[model samples]
Target: MIAAISENDIKKLKEDLKQKGYKLTPQRRAIVDTIIAGKGSHLTAEEIYDEVKKLCPEIGLATVYRTIILLEEIGLIYKLELNDGCSRYELANKDEVHRHHHLVCNKCGSVIEVQDDLLENLETEIEKKYNFKIKDHSVKFFGLCSECRKDG
Candidate 1:
């Protein structure tokens, strides 16, 4: 797939960083670029830090943590805390459909994005039937994925 980080998006991110007085250091920019380079794939901070190391080996792990936290604070990305104790992050694409829910393979820890509007509609119906307003929510469907099922 084409790299998810488009020139327009990077330009906008640069502008946002500038307005916030966040220093656009080479390492920081490279880290962002690298993260976006992964496109739809969610990556942990350690994975990101390791990739950044190839480009700038001297960069510290703490620097990656700080930068990711700052970026998340600014709403540039979404941080997902998996039950596995590792946090995976992906760039926030405002124009696309929100990939909010997940289908998790309990055996393999494989996460698949579930972008089903029907599920949302069902939730809405349930809320209306119960005479309650539904706020934000997250759903994880856990079962053995195809590979795991085949293995068993």
Candidate 2:
């Protein structure tokens, strides 16, 4: 299914890419369309490749990787490196704000977002105590999800 991303969003993305000296090619546009269609935040490069292939079978994996890297550099998406040694991606925007930490189900490999103001405070305290500046951080908590635990 084709995802619904606003025309304004596409135009803005193209402007952003042009600012960074990148062109909005048809392949990259199709990839963005697939990402826009998806519901969840987590997506793998292979997943993107599969979706884009429907529109452009001639597109290559390397091109997808390169496009993802470029998009990441412009802060259009966040690259998530899970403990399982694979990278996933999600769009970053004001509405779908980035959160700290995740509740991951080990058995089912599901990821749920966890919001913790305490974690933000702790990071601030650490930075103050050490007289150091913190830019960004990532955290993950792994265990059985409620359903998995109940099923066990």
Candidate 3:
């Protein structure tokens, strides 16, 4: 909850934008800060805009949408679609070779991030049998979380 965006992170992001012929404007920085601060929450565009607006009252919703697209394109963030109406986003960790999976509680609609890959052996077997290289994979499980199970 106490997530802090380091200056190095902002600098790196600025450099990434520079390569794409963009600059880290104040509004974009505020958006990035909001996303970085709430990295694990998997915020939607509207939620991000709401948070960013507190810091930048002049920011617009369309600007948040555009910035989200640009950040995702630059690999600074990852988009997550839960088959719901809205899309969510989380900051992309620079050191992550493979993204983590999510466990969604059907009863409560709560999502828990599973940090382990847990599919190395399966991926290896499939790659060897199919003669195809694996790039990345996402796995989501729908079930009752502990709290929901207890409540039930």
Candidate 4:
């Protein structure tokens, strides 16, 4: 099941696109809505395309791919490479202070969201030692999920 997106979020997204000189057309809206609906699920381009096609039959795969790339470039989404040979994406949270990690199930290919900011210490150490500024990061732990471990 898809999560419900708030009207405020939709309005802000529309304003963002307009500021970027991109019109929020029906196809674009459909694509964004699909991504927002699958909040926790890291959906692949093909998966997103399939979902968007249900709303806009005339939308093409290339358009979906392009839009995904554009959204990622604009920091509206995060692209993840979970070592599954397929790129997945999730929406960027409004509060950038708390970033979430991922627990990927190797057996079933399920992606679980881990909300703990486990890298705060590491990030602080790296910044202090290297004199570098860290803007963002992503972490993924690959292992068997509960059901998969039980079956094994």
Candidate 5:
């Protein structure tokens, strides 16, 4: 599950945007608020657009796409490829903690979040042996979830 973004975090993000020579427009703020509100949902672009439309009726799909791209560029959000064809997005961890992995149910297409950092030792080993710095990583385990296993 995704973590919630506090109001202070939002204020900090707006300040960061201004410092980076970007304007926090109403549409962009609405988009960010929507994403923050739907923390655990891993919303897609279309889903975000649909929700943002409710807040700003004049907002367009292209604007949502551009805003998402900008957010990802600014390291405020993560674009995830969960192997379900559509790209999903979640807020970036503000504390620089390791990101949670995902358990994707192949049968039902449900995504379950795994909060542990399972690759700490592996990352250390790789860095020590190969002298390759690991900036970030993601893992996805594919299998049947409890309900899907029962059904199968």
Candidate 6:
């Protein structure tokens, strides 16, 4: 599971938003709290809205969508696009320069997070060859999970 969000992290996020001329309103806070609580789930906007509605019953789906977009815009979250036709999101880890890779099970539609940075050597070689300043990268591998293989 991903690291749990801390109160300090939330405070820092609020300050970051303030610096960016945005405020963390009540609805946004509920959405963010839901995202924090759902770590490693890679929740979609609809799922976030559903959870946020439990807290802010008057919350609208459009607000969730807008908050998600703003968070992505501010680099507070990362939107992961897989073949499932749903845009999933996870909190950005400030300590990690590169986003962790993901293993997507094609059969069961389950995501297994790959915590290893398996592309370092390849990234180094590419940077050396192309003289590119590599910052970060994302990778997703799709295949059947162990259970799916067993069932198949």
> What lDDT score is found at residue 25 in candidate 2?
94
Tens-digit lDDT track for model 5 on 120-140? 999999999999999888888
Score residue 72 of candidate 1 by CA lDDT: 88
Question: Order of candidates by lDDT, top first?
Answer: 3, 6, 5, 4, 2, 1
lDDT of 6: 0.88
Please write out the lDDT profile of model 4 over residues 14-125, one tens digit for every residue: 7888888887788987888899898887899999999999889999999999899878877788898989899988889988675589899999988888887889999999
Q: Which candidate has the highest lDDT of all?
A: 3
Model 6 ranges off by over 4 Å: 1-5
Model 2: lDDT equals 0.81
Sort the predicted structures by TM-score, highest score first: 3, 6, 5, 4, 2, 1
The model with the greater lDDT, 1 or 6, is 6
Quote each prediction's TM-score.
Answer: 0.81, 0.85, 0.93, 0.90, 0.91, 0.92
Candidate 4: misplaced stretches above 4 Å?
A: 1-4
Q: Which 10-residue window of candidate 1 scores lowest in summed lDDT?
A: 1-10
What TM-score should be assigned to candidate 2?
Answer: 0.85
Per residue, candidate 2 scores C-alpha lDDT tens digits across 1-152 of: 88687788888888999998988899988888777676466889999898889899999999999998998888778788767778998766535333456778889888987665346687779999999887667778889999999999
RMSD of 6: 2.2
CA RMSD for every model?
2.9, 2.2, 1.5, 1.7, 2.4, 2.2
For model 6, how does the per-residue alpha-carbon lDDT over 1-152 read when each residue is reduced to its tens digit? 22356889779889989998989898888877788788789999999888889899998898899899999888888899988899999988787879999999998999998888889999999999999989989999999999999998
lDDT of each: 0.79, 0.81, 0.89, 0.87, 0.87, 0.88
| Model 3 lDDT tens row, 68-150 | 99999999998988766689998887787788899988877788998888999999999999999998888889889999999
Candidate 6 colliding pairs? none
Per-residue lDDT of candidate 1, residues 2-115 (tens digit): 245668877878888888888778888878877888756789999999888888899999999999998887778878766888889987767645447777888988888776
Superposition error at 29 for model 5 (Å)? 1.0
Q: What does the lDDT come to for candidate 4?
A: 0.87
